[model samples]
Target: MIDPRTPVLVGVAQFVDRDSLSADALSPLDLLAAVSGAALADSGGRGVVVDTLAVVRLFADSSPAFRSPFGSYANLPKSLAARLGQAPRRTIYGPVGGNTPQLLVNLLAESIRSGASDVALIAGGEALRTQARAQKMGLALDWSEDPGGEPETLGPETRLVSAHEVAHGIAMPTAVYPLFESALAAHYGDDPLAHRRRIGALMAGFTRVAAANSYAALPVERTADELITPTDDNRYIAYPYTKYLCSNMFVDQAAALLLMSTAAADAAGVPVSARVYLHGSADVHDMILVSQRLDYHSSPAIRAGAAQALAQAGIGVAELDHIDLYSCFPVAVEIAADMIGLAHDDPRGLTLTGGLPYFGGPGNAYSLHAIAEMAARCHAAPGSKGLVFANGGYLTKHSFGVYSTDHPANPARIDPTLLQAALDAAESPPFVESPAGAGTVEAITIPHERGIHGPATVIVRLDSGHRALAVIDTEAAALIDTQVVGRRVNLTPGHPINHARFE
Candidate 1:
């Protein structure tokens, strides 16, 4: 018989509220409670074993000043538990990251494997769409709930980027990811036009998958030319990233997963068909600061985590029947594919849930939907394996998991710190918080706001070979539409800002 402590995922559910503009729209807590309850019902209706509940942190909850147009919950996990009438002994609120959902799963699996917990529920939800719509219509939604008392926070609350990065306007994901995009394009020797078409084709495939998914936020299929070719509707948010290429965060979506030890599942009488095993998982992070990365074209953390996960599962990439690489941007997917040794047109599609762009990002909870989908796929095709790759920050944190219906003959083992130590040991390029004199432009991104051009932000290699960020004025921004990498420029460092000009 399999070890009673072997952790297995027994149930998963996802809820997408496309009609959040209506009166029936659920708040974030409500969505979480509903999905958690649904997951319980899906898993043989066992309520006695829910000793732990973990919730993925929400973006709106990060700021004390962010008053939701729909009043928000003070304690998300506890409020959700009360609504479901499940008194879990421990409540956990995870950190902010696209990788949190999967990371939590890996952590909870360890807890169950150690016999510290018999069962756990992991859930997350976002009602940003309803909040935005209500605010636009000048209506106030009262989703306020104070369950009292704080839950134990699971992850660190440290800032992901540095003060220097923020000073140079390299803070937001949109601005920073495009720098990676430009570098990746250059690595492939593709010109501006050619690279645009290539990424467009890649995203168009995602849109087609989204069109077929019932829960996709924007399910309309789009063509490669339609996606890459900017129009009045799909304007450029940042160069090389049109509106269609970015993650759709304006979505009301929620997902939940229930994991129980094999003994608990058996006691609950969960059908054999409903069981999915957690074969292997690994979490790792690259250099926290993008400017300090060894290179821009790839992610060593992703490569390390993926390899470790597959190795732990005793399987190879060829055995994966389904895959869902985090698709916050085209570059994310492309870089992940290259690192995982997956071809762009692999027999197994890159995304199992369309992707973040089409399926809906839902803040940090996007990967929860991917996990839910992967669980369902495993149930449908027993013994077939699926892979879920999640990323956080600007390709800084990564987590990988492999799942299947077949239980491993060997015990499940996860070394959470191995990948992290490897990342920390890797050499980081020297980064200058501020630099002066002549420099060579390594990569640049010119962002647009509502079809209007903005200042150009460039990552330059200074005379000393250290990387620094600089912003160019409108005069220099005009030259950004063309290839600017390798262009010699002069940098003038100022208080909290640095200016650059083409030589």
Candidate 2:
């Protein structure tokens, strides 16, 4: 018999506003309420009490690039709670990371299973596109609110890039993901042109799904050439990554999820067709710093997390009927698929909501929408299995969940410490702040200026087997056309950061 305390998702909702300039544009608070109301109605809950409410960190507050000129909300959850007429016993605000949504659901489900809580609501939204348009058009907008109390915080907030990596002009996702792309290409022994074509075709599949998704920000389907080829509209953000390859964060989107015990679902008369159980779940993180990673092409965290979740679900990768691997960039998907034992071009399909690049990556809450979409899929096809893998930071943090319409025999949440400790104790290469002399390139990222080539940033392994970061200025044609990984280079330590020249 299934545990009465087992957590099941009863309701989920998503919202997308394409017209930010409309007279009735919703603010962040309004967006949360919109999704929350829809989710509550979807659950068919009548006078159901919520003991916990959690809100994912917003993009504007997470990064300076998305920073809003408007004042901040003192307590984001309280604001949402007050707006929704919810006085949950515990209010929570999640930390900054794309994995926060799935991580929260996994942990909160464990809470419900343990009877620590009854019903819980998770919600998040982003008005970034609206905020940007207002700012650019010199229009006044205010997202600030004071709800009068501090909420308990969940998850970690760490500085992703190190001082050294930033010094070498490697800071944002656009610059860093290309490092993985280049390394992955070298790992597969593929040429630059062929690799581009391969990744282009791979991501083209996502666009096709996006074209059909009403919630997708970039909903137009694109081919391999339309995706990878550098044109005026599709400029190269970084080598091996065109503008289309990156996640589209400039979209107004929101999503919310409602979870409660199976007993609670039955008490509320939530229909069996609307209920989706958590078959398995796992969350883990790798070395935080980009330079401290074991390798560029793969994520140890993904491998470990997926293994734990799959084991708990009493299923293997081969059995998963529906899947959505986080797709912030091509390498993120490539690495996740490689580590999780899913094929890059699996006929079963890789994304449920097109993915981050095509679907609106609404800050840390993108996976919530993916999970919501998964619930709808499971509801349509009973007994079908689905897996959602979410990544945060530079593929350093991971969260995986296995879901199904069929009730599981046993609880699937397990202590991740055992496997997580093993990954934590895994050795990483020694790092050097500054270095001189001969070394070999592990990966390289070239920045483009106004669609033209800029200086190239390189990650090198010194003759002493120590990793270092450096930069070199050269003709675009020199490094652009040819694969430079494994090429010899001489490094020279200098102020600000180290410099390297091709040898």
Best-fitting candidate, measured by lDDT?
A: 2
lDDT of 1 by residue, 196-254 (tens): 88998888889989999997888889999998877899888888788999988889999
lDDT of each: 0.86, 0.88
Question: Which pairs of residues clash in candidate 1, taking residues 3 or more apart in a chain or in different chains?
Answer: none
Error of 2 at 412 (Å): 4.3
For residues 1-503, write the lDDT of model 2, one tens digit per residue. Answer: 77789899999999998863864567888889899888988998787778899999898778888778877889989888888888999999998888989999998999999998889999998988888787788776777899798999964567888777898887888888898889899999988889999999999999999899988877888898999998899888888788898898878899999999988888888887888988899999989888998988888889989999989999999999999999999998999999999888999999999988888788889999999999989988999999999999888789999999999866857899898899889889999987989999998898886678778898999999999998875565578747888889999997877888888
Model 1 lowest lDDT segment of ten: 473-482
Model 2 residue runs over 4 Å out of place are none
Alpha-carbon RMSD, candidate 1: 1.6
Q: Can you give the lDDT of residue 147 in candidate 2?
A: 72
lDDT of 2: 0.88
